[model samples]
Target chain A: MIKTKIWVIVISLILTVSAALSVIIFTLPKKNVVAIYSDGELLREIDLSEVAEPYTFKVEHGDGFNEILVERGRIRVSFADCPDRCCVNYGWYYGGASPVVCIPHKLVIKAVNSQKDDFDVVTG
Target chain B: MKTKRIALDAVLTALALSVFIIEQQIPLPIPVPGVKLGLSNVVTLFALFAVSPLDALLILSLRIGIGNVFAGSVTGLIFSAAGGLLCYVTELILYKFLTDRQIWVCGVFGAIAHGVGQIFAAVGVSATAEIFIYLPVLILCGIVTGALTGSLAQVSVIKLKKVFPFLPFRRKKEEKQN
Candidate 1:
């Protein structure tokens, strides 16, 4: 039988590695260009740094919709028809490794470092 | 004997479902989806080690199916099913290798597998690989929460056997020797 000590060591090692990786992910540099995707399609891209005024718009998907609020240097899901409202609870996205996700609607908003000339190529 | 087993399974299923629903009420500090204490897994772990794998599987499946319908979203079912299935499979395999003392190890590995399964499901439904950014955090959360639930199960397995000796709970090495 496998000793308990070995199990402890292995679990500890994984815990440390994942903890370090999480730190790296959370501390990564923030990007300014944000792309919004729905059903794997690029619906819109906005340069957060260039926004002169705050605006809100609704992205409808089937029977539900996500109200997106874009501000000067950040973006957020102001509201959503999805039951979980996890995307809305995500508060604000200022550009990080993690994307603002709405799983029910198959929507994702992620920050990109560089602007792509052709959206189709990026999705492809 | 068969009737007793069925009654036990029903009781365990109800216990798991209650825990699952109550856990949903405990709002998490982290708003990121799929991150929670997963306290209901304690029942699954206990059932796996103390009862039987088949009973554990039945309890887990029923809890996920009905629990989601009660407190989760329609799309949320996909994530729950994927994660729960992977977690149960991992624990089932680990059960053969681990002594009763090491049930927590099963919890750790099973929790990690659950996180991975959730990520796969999220990627498929969203059709965006970018959602994978949550992987590391999810794994880290899994390990911490898994250990807690695992230890609780271990305790229950040890203590409950004496309380309900009629149940076919496995005895620890020391208890077997005694």
Candidate 2:
């Protein structure tokens, strides 16, 4: 049987590595393009850098909807009808690796590197 | 013996459910979804070490199923079920390798598996592979919270065994043979 000290050291190593990785990922450079997805389908793609005016739009999925607010360089779910309101609480998406997600509504807003736009061209 | 086992399972299920409900009310500062203290897991951990693995599994399933009915959404159920299932399996496997004193190790790894399972469910439901970005932060949160809850389970198992020696704890049986 492995000793308890061995288990402690192993788990501590994992904990430290993940903590360092999280810091690195969070601090990585921000992107300019953001994609809005509902039920895996791309609903809208906005280049945050190009937004001249702030606006709010509603994306409805069945009985629920997310009110998304977009400013010049950031986007956020300003309101959501979902029970948890996790998306709205997520505050804003400013082109980070992490995407704002609402599991209930199957909605996700994520940053996309503009260069990759050619691969998955947005469809009307 | 069967009746005693059933009664114990029911009580542990209730305890897990109550913890699940109360945990929902405590607002977490982090806005990221699928992140919580998961204190209810303490009961499951205790059950796994002190009680039988079968008892642990029963209590976990009941807590996930009924707990969702009371305070969760349909989608929430899917996430909880996925996470709980993965976490239980991880703990079950680890249980054999570690002694009772090392239950905390099970907690840490089990919590990490739970995070991974939740991420898979989230990606599948949303159809967004980018959701993987949350993996690192989720794992980080899992380590911290898992350690806390695991230690809680370790202490509970030790103390509760002393207080209620009649309960069918696996450790008690092992001690008798030794």
> Would you list the C-alpha lDDT of every candidate in the order shown?
0.85, 0.86
- Give the best candidate by lDDT: 2
Location of the lowest summed lDDT over 10 successive residues in candidate 2 chain A: A115-124
State the lDDT of candidate 2 residue by residue for A13-123, as single tens digits: 988998898889778643489999999999989988788899999999999999999998889999999999989888876776677899999999987774433334343
Residues B1-178 of candidate 2: C-alpha lDDT, one tens digit per residue: 7888899999999999999999998888875678989898899999999989999999999999999999759988999999999999999999988776777888888888888899999999989788788898889899889999999998898888889999877773343110
What is the DockQ score of candidate 1, to 2 decimals?
Answer: 0.38
- Can you write out model 1's per-residue Cα lDDT over B96-125, one digit (the tens) per residue? 878777777888888888888899999999
Q: In angstroms, how far off is B93's CA in candidate 1? A: 0.9
Model 2, residue pairs in steric clash: none
For model 1, the stretches where C-alpha displacement exceeds 4 angstroms are A30-124, B170-178
Deviation in Å, model 2, residue B143 alpha carbon: 0.9
Candidate 2 wrongly placed segments (more than 4 Å): A29-46, A49-124, B172-178
- Predicted structure with the largest DockQ when compared to the true one: 1
Candidate 1: TM-score of chain A is 0.66
